[model samples]
Target: MRLKLAFLMSAVLAAGCGWSGADATTESGGGTIEYWLWDSGQQPGYQKCADSFAKQNPGLNVHISQYGWDVYWSKLTAGFIADTAPDVFTDHLAKFAQFVDLGVLRPLDELAPTADINDGDYQEGLAELWKGQDGKRYGSPKDWDTIAMFYNPGALRAAGFSPDDLSDLSWNPRDGGTFEKMIAHLTVDKNGVRGDEPGFDKNNVSQYGLGSDGAGGGGWGQTQWSAFAGSAGWQVTDRNPWGTRFNLDQPAFQDTLTWYFGLARKGYMPSFAEIGGNNPVGPDKQIQSGLAAIALDGSWKISTFQNLTDTSGQKLKVGIAPTPIGPSGKRASMFNGLADSVTSLSKQPDNAAKWVKFMSGEECQNIIGESGIVFPARPSGTEKAIAFNKDKRQLDVTPFTDQVKDKTTFLFPVTTNAADITALLQPRMDAVYIGESPVSSLTTVNDQLNDLFKVAQ
Candidate 1:
């Protein structure tokens, strides 16, 4: 895992500028540390964290930047190559392994210990994910997430179903089971015909049964088809963390995706063409505008969907449901988490490490939890987040945690060559989703990926 990306890092990294250091200060031998993250929704909570960290360590300052997911990676890669990356930045499991292979991450082992951080401080197994094959740690756990189905209670009732009906929805690749039935029933045509009704036109849909945030969630599909596929007993890789082989070509996986994308064909889902304008409409907007009945999304989105309001500023009524049970006879959610990492290029590695440490601490994590933005890393923080959402915000978030409690959550696949893997898979998956290519074509793509992995760095 350490050197797997040696073959592709240069090509993937941008060709411009090098190590532009963060703004430095001479105050009592302290300096400013720049932190970058991709989620705008979590910015306010993290900003408070930054403020608190600075107050605790006088003379040191923290600067924060928020970028969209796509821009965040591109900018991080550019910074890495140009030597101008932020001092401390949020890291994803998918990308961190590649960063480890490229030797651009400062191992957290020694630094983590100094701050009294250990794997026990975070959700089970999250801290272990940042370790490379060489046993060097690169990330300190922050917050965790799992996928769930988000729905509009009003739409479900109008469709002649109640929120409880979603509690036990079952699915299968052959026919989509009760889950697809619910989606079809929830869909409404322009002329007021439901999708399950006769003469329900596939075209001219007034309300799609499902909404999406992207074309296909790239290769990971954490919020797209992951839950469905996983619950159907499809594993993304042979194992987690160090697995080199992908299961994209597996029959069950292919069949699952074929049915998932086929929903677009049935006009029950948002087609790429429908959401492909300059500004793509996300699930939240679709649900808020009464255009989509439900969407599969990450727990991180609880507040986003729950806080959604209409044009008149009235809060939209949204409900949460677990992933539908599948042929595996269980529900599944991709267990993903965010972490903070200090860059190998940082001008203030110590301060940056300290900031990363502080972010994972009880106070900072609790602040994040109380904000109702996300579930923080610590157990206490997770409890606080649940209470905040349930008691204060009037939202029960157990569906997200229930996956973990039931042991139906799978870890995000972690391996090197992540950027290359996505680069290879995204376009082909998009083609499949848009009906340009058969789902079976992924078999060849999987073979090609295996050849890349065979390099053994």
Candidate 2:
């Protein structure tokens, strides 16, 4: 999910043309700081914090900007190249190494002491994720996410299974274990036949057992197949935070990919033609329309899924489940965190740092947590977020938070050439998903990826 880029160049061009427009400035204090984020859902919460921040600091002002995920990254990249990047912006782990290498990010270590920002105040390992290979901090932790299964309880019951039956589902590469069995039982055809039945029609299926956002796994499957691959004892790289060797060609990874894609061939999952064709559907829509029984997604989508309504305007009751245990005798998830980074070319670095510090502070995090949008990076804020979801949204988020408390999550792959690596391997991965190529085809792509890694070094 991190590696997927769906930017529209036309929109980027339009934004670039208006870079010098009035939308770029708003006076506060004695100067203004430009801040950018991609998530529109979190805008209101941060806007409230920004207004409060400006009130307290009479001499400084912060102008917040929101954009779609793809447009946000594209504009940020164009701004960096033009030496007109935002004063401060939210950063992702997938792009962290590249931004650090480009020297577009200011080291937060120097600003932390002056701003009274303590790295220890944040969640464990989160602050560390923002540190560069040179041992300098580039960003401040904002929030974190983990992968989990989202299912409709009514659909499960229709399939003759209860919500309790979903607990502790196990998987394997060879036969898919109990996980595949569950999926097959849940899949139904237009003629009222289940996938597990002998007369079921693969082509005329009315509902899929499982659904994905797109064709499924990409270079980094944070919300896709990473759970399976990680639990099978596979790692994207030999080490993280600066690993040189990639292990996508390993047998464990290949075996997992084979089994994952086989679901498409068996009609338990959407086929590539259905997923990638015109009028393509996403996991959320599929579940809301009763075309899919289950979907694997990130914790950040909890609010969106909970608020979805079907054709008759009935609120869809979504349930959460942890990933199934794999061959390694455990379940796994990608532990990824997002942070805010100041630009190296900012005209007001001091003001920018102040804003970043405040945004990442406990006060603003508490506001964000109370919004029930995501799990804030601060432990206290995280507690408030869990409580908000339970009390207000009535959703159980333990399936996601439990991975962190249980220490069953792995860090997302962190490498300097992540973009290039994703660019090179994505097509091959697409082929695997479409059944045009076998999982072993990744060996050739792996070699290409290692070459790119060498060049990055």
Candidate 3:
């Protein structure tokens, strides 16, 4: 059942099916441009920039529409099939190669202001990360984010440790390490049971040290799992960007999974079944309900965490940390970037290009950064973003942004059939997390993934 739902969502992320049709059209005038996006939270931010663009191009009108991520993709795929796709649309690194291969998206180099699109000005390695296999840049960056360890301050204090102690800690898969020790310490139970305690009850625990389900969701795309993959020095593919290969066969990959899932097996973290409900998007119910201490989450969770009030409307205190460095001697993470791509089918290519360029430009990025929802893609915009969040409850987010500087930052896998590979892999991964299966699932996952790449070849 879990596998079926995961595959269904993967199709939505891959092709965008079964949604209301996109009937919104750009104004007939040379002035109006159509724009589409998935984030409602970002609509206001985009509107601010659209207003600015309207002022500058007085004759031009910007039309913006919001769609749920699933619906957004479905509508987008429908638009492409009908040749009525939006003039400008948000894009992502995971699926950009397929669009590039189909020749539907306009390469940014063909548009105006090419000189201002300085890849060097952006964070090291990130701008280049958005370029497609056709050797053309499809979109300039809007913002960037990396995974970090978010914890409860009170929980850490009660465990006889200060958050400061973990400020520069690292991890590896030896007998025991700083990271494992911390997880054990942070884990507590009402009857004097801790993860390291001899008689710790894996079945009946009070507060789990960590909170997480297995990896891969549309929002963050399998949070903890990807980090584990990176720490193991695994890449989803080697040849073409669209090729799929599984790293699960490696000792490092298996080792990382064992260590990560150990948190659950040892009663330090919630079981996979405990968190992923009929709809996996729920409040990691354990963490939100305060039954768990630390959970793997994204930067955007800051707002949800802030607004999450108990029955009495009290806010939770959250602290942030850089992902733990692994045996590879480096901190690693899976970084996914979304791009704005113009459809080849658009009748108003000129207007579409302008909208795409403007939204991905510095001004638009600044507006989004100012809202504190995400970090601006440009390195220069970091200060403004930090200032915007300086007064907010989620302070010290600088480290989250700072990790982007680490050389090991990686973009998510991109394969023509990646959607299919992820679909096949996710549920098997879920089974592994639930302890319903073993390392053998790796063989099935790898074979399925490789089959997609074979078809691509």
Candidate 4:
């Protein structure tokens, strides 16, 4: 889920206090190179990698710093504007195209020969996503992710549905199928009336059956509605990576969205307005607060949900399930991954490339896998991640990993004009989610989105 990260600002103020970057000395071969990332949860793991690298290469320091997602991107954009960006930082499939266009990221192939890296060392189709239309590698593969449904076991039992019932849940745009029925049964209002029960008031709803990390998932629903759209067999572009045309207005996609957003009106899901503005309550918090019984979320939040604490700080047990079956007769998830790119602004390009290579290597990636926060791109590291989470953390990440093995995962749309795509679609999609605009309005936006690719040509 490329656009599907949880917007938890719990570390915002602390993370944004200062930016530990842009100070790499213009020395020959040995100097400190700054690295930055958005996820505070993954900082410790990367910090250890930085320490290992620094220890291996004396006099060449790697300063790893983290910031909130909003501030991370803002600071990154501002740094790019000022030509003072970090030497090496985490990169996403959605944003790298823009950086490649701006010529701010140094191509890995152009780096010093001493910093040797191999594409074959990573997972299939991962390192390939970091390549531009110019056919130059801009990033080294780090980790990958997918989407799944996480629910409160207590809530599922209360609704008279066993954990096994979720396995065969079927969905369609027409009547929502058994998935909708389960959502209805799980939803309860102020009077403790289930959504399926008579006299249930949607207005006085206290608990929703479904929740997401965000409202409008931009052009890619990801955690919001992507599981349904993807399972319904909808794709964002005609062809990814370098697509010239888009399928944002396809009937299959339109129908999927229509039913997806309709859940809010039925009080089975929270409306965009009900959730906190700008800083929304993520599915993890929703489960913790008793506002939602089930939530479709990305695999990146595996650690948080698997080890959750209630508002009163008591342990809350949560289980995950694969996305329900759709008209496509299969489950689906957006396959996404992250990488680290050395900035063109770096004075220590060789050292920066070395750092990036090391991070992508088995040693560093294995260290990251052991953190149990994400699945690394390297198969060896990925296996380590699966084992550590299941054995140590007691996390059942099979549903997430199964999507990859079962071939039920689709790539996150990788193309240029990603920011522009989100700008044009967010407000309109938010309107659709809130019932302020018809889903048909996106047909027009979709046309406009296609125009962006046309204009590029």
Candidate 5:
């Protein structure tokens, strides 16, 4: 399933120097292993872990570098083509299959045994998720995330609603059920009229009911519409961990997309014009600015949302809510994890493996967990993360953790042509988001996606 590296220098150069930060270059006559990560929020914690690793293994320095998500992937791909990929870098499940297929990832089974890295230490199915289609492990589980509703308590209170009102929201593809009603109730117009009211103006709405990181277009909508789709009994593919056939054309999926986009048309959500514009504001910023009352985001963003402050310098009190139940009578989320992988191009394979091992091990995971950044992949670390959020951050992460414990989660789609599929679907999805196309328009796009899957095979 491997494809040759199609290195486009123009694209790589267009990515620019945004990936450059914190001098992690190896010094002459010294052993310095370069590591890269996307989450700047976890940088200080991982830096602490690296310092600890250096102290324990004298003369070996772990230099960490970070970049924004999009830039990180572009540079990492460019590095792979140039044979200058990092010794170790954090990897995502969505991207790992493609990396493994391209032979860029180093197998980790032998190294894990030597490093005493127990696969059992990771959460259920996490270790297996790092395995390639050939049944070889390519990464070590680092941390996991699930989606939940992040709400601004101030906005909810201003609407004369309690936080408890968000607990049992439900949805249906037909009318959107209680979920749509709740969103309408929470939305407000410029004239201080709620969206559910008769005279409410959709044209001059002052606040939206919900928001998320991305607008509902492109390949996947894990944070945007996937929860609703999953709860409505829609699956991205027939199977995962190597699903060859995409199920984008299914009725349930089309129905879910229809309802999701209908919210924007109803002025319950922001339009693509608002979200994808130049100088577009993010969902977190929307909630912080009182423009959005709720946001469906991942657990990794908890710290960011909890620390949001208004223009008056007052901390915004955020509450967590589980995703609404759909017609299938259950809530759902994408159970995804991040892992650290060694690059096959590395000259120091053993060193890279050691670093990956240490990074995914209890020592480093504990530090990451206690920082309240993300729930670490290991069970013990997850416990620490829960406790840290509850006792220190005073935020209940149960809305996220409960999905894992209750088995109400689905795996992120794993396909070798994820990037290609995304490129093909994004414009079409954007069309749907802007009300220029109907949900049924995706049937044609789905055919194109399935054709790509065939080519991938």
Candidate 6:
């Protein structure tokens, strides 16, 4: 057990941009640590953390910039090549592999206090995700998210079932499964039609049981493919980022893709063709408009959905559950997380490390937790964070909280090209779902990706 634990810790230590000697500079007051983050939702909470941090280190300046997720990564990559990256910035586990290879960010091990930070202080899976290709830790754990099944109570009632019946329903790719039945039952038509009806008229259907917003269709896996792909033991890349090989052509992967599209064909889900384009159809819209009974998404959307007020200002009674299991007998999720890493060219290494440690600490996490903005990356901190949300916000985030246990699975790739491949594949995936071509159309996507990996090799 100790050896396994040690290996896990080593993996965590391996993924990020390690601290550099360039990070060494004395804080003589008036040094600014530019911080870039994606969650505008957490700005209020994180601003509080910043204020507390500023109070603790009066000489340091924190410049926090918030960007939408898509823009943030693009900008960060540009900054890296230009040597203008932030002194300390937020990073995603999925994006870490790419940045680590660029050697633009600093590793956390050099900055972390040996006595305070060890393998056990974090959730091992999250730790592993933050490790870089050189076997060095690039980012320190901040928060983690898992996929959940969010459904509308009203929609379920209309479908002749309640949240309870669907709560524990199991799933597999085969037909006539419990999950399939609930999905079919939850689907309804504007003319009071259900998907199971013979003349269901899928073209004119009013509501669907599941939604896979065309955002993650063709070669893209994060939002759509990654979640379902995991249930079938499909990985975006082998364990090492530098050793990537596309697995999309593999049988396990093809099976998942076929099954996912099958849901669309059966009228149990919204056909990519039905959604009309690649634009995302937000979860709140699906539930509020009575267009979908259930949607697979993250807990981060919980508060947003709860706070959404319609034209009549009515709110839906929604509940969340873990992502369903597959033939492999495991509940899979696309684990996404963020971390704080130092810049290799920072003017003040010591101060930067201090900032990184402070932000990644339980105190900061406790603050983020109370706001119900995100779960802390540390295991102990996460529990307290969830409990805090329950007591302070009167929101039960336990469904997302409990799913982070051994039951959860994450998509980890072996190469920095993972992000590049994902970007190229999304549009093609969108093509597949929109009926632009068949599933085999994605064959070129995998082929090109395999070629990219070979070049990197």
Name every residue pair that clashes in candidate 1: 17-82, 18-82, 19-82, 19-83
* Candidate 2 C-alpha lDDT tens digits along 15-117: 8986665433322225788899998889999998899899989977888889898688889998887666788899999898899998999888777432455
Query: Where's the lowest-lDDT run of ten residues in candidate 4?
Result: 1-10
Assess every candidate by TM-score. 0.91, 0.92, 0.86, 0.92, 0.92, 0.86
What is the TM-score of candidate 5? 0.92
Better of 1 and 3 by TM-score: 1
- What lDDT tens digits, residue by residue, belong to model 3 across residues 1-457? 9999999999887776556555555333467777888978778988999999999877888888899877887798888887667778888776677777778888778767542577776666667766776668877677776777777777788888888877766777654368778877777777867777787777877788877745452322446766656765766566434344655577767676767776788777777666664255333345557676666666655565545554465676667777777766777776665567777776776777777677767787778778887777776565677777777544878657766765667766666654665577777777777788885667667777677767777
Give the per-residue lDDT digits (tens) of candidate 5, residues 366-398. Answer: 999999899999999999999999999888999
lDDT of each: 0.86, 0.85, 0.70, 0.86, 0.85, 0.71
RMSD in Å for all candidates: 8.7, 8.1, 8.9, 9.5, 7.8, 12.9
Candidate 5 lDDT? 0.85
Task: Quote model 6's TM-score.
Answer: 0.86
- Give the higher-lDDT candidate: 1 or 5: 1
Across residues 1-457, which tens digit of lDDT does each residue of candidate 1 receive? 6476864676446333454445342121347888899999899999999899889999887889899997999989988886778888999998998888888998887664334568888888888887887887888899999999899888888888889999999999898899999999999999999998999998899999988665553648888899988998988889888887889889889889889998999989988778773256877888998889999888988988988997789888799999999999999999989899988887767888888888989999999999988889898999999999999878889999999878999999987788778888888877887789999999999997887788756
- What does candidate 4's lDDT look like per residue over 7-49, in tens digits? 4453565568785554543232358888999988899999999
Best by lDDT: 4
Superposed model 4: Cα runs more than 4 Å off: 1-30, 113-116
Error of 6 at 352 (Å): 1.9
The CA lDDT at 3 in model 4 is 34
Tell me model 1's lDDT, rounded to 2 decimals.
0.86
Question: TM-score of predicted model 1?
Answer: 0.91
- Residue 80 CA error for candidate 5 (Å)? 1.7
Can you tell me which runs of candidate 3 are displaced by over 4 Å?
Answer: 1-30, 113-116, 190-192, 217-222, 239-246, 281-286, 391-394
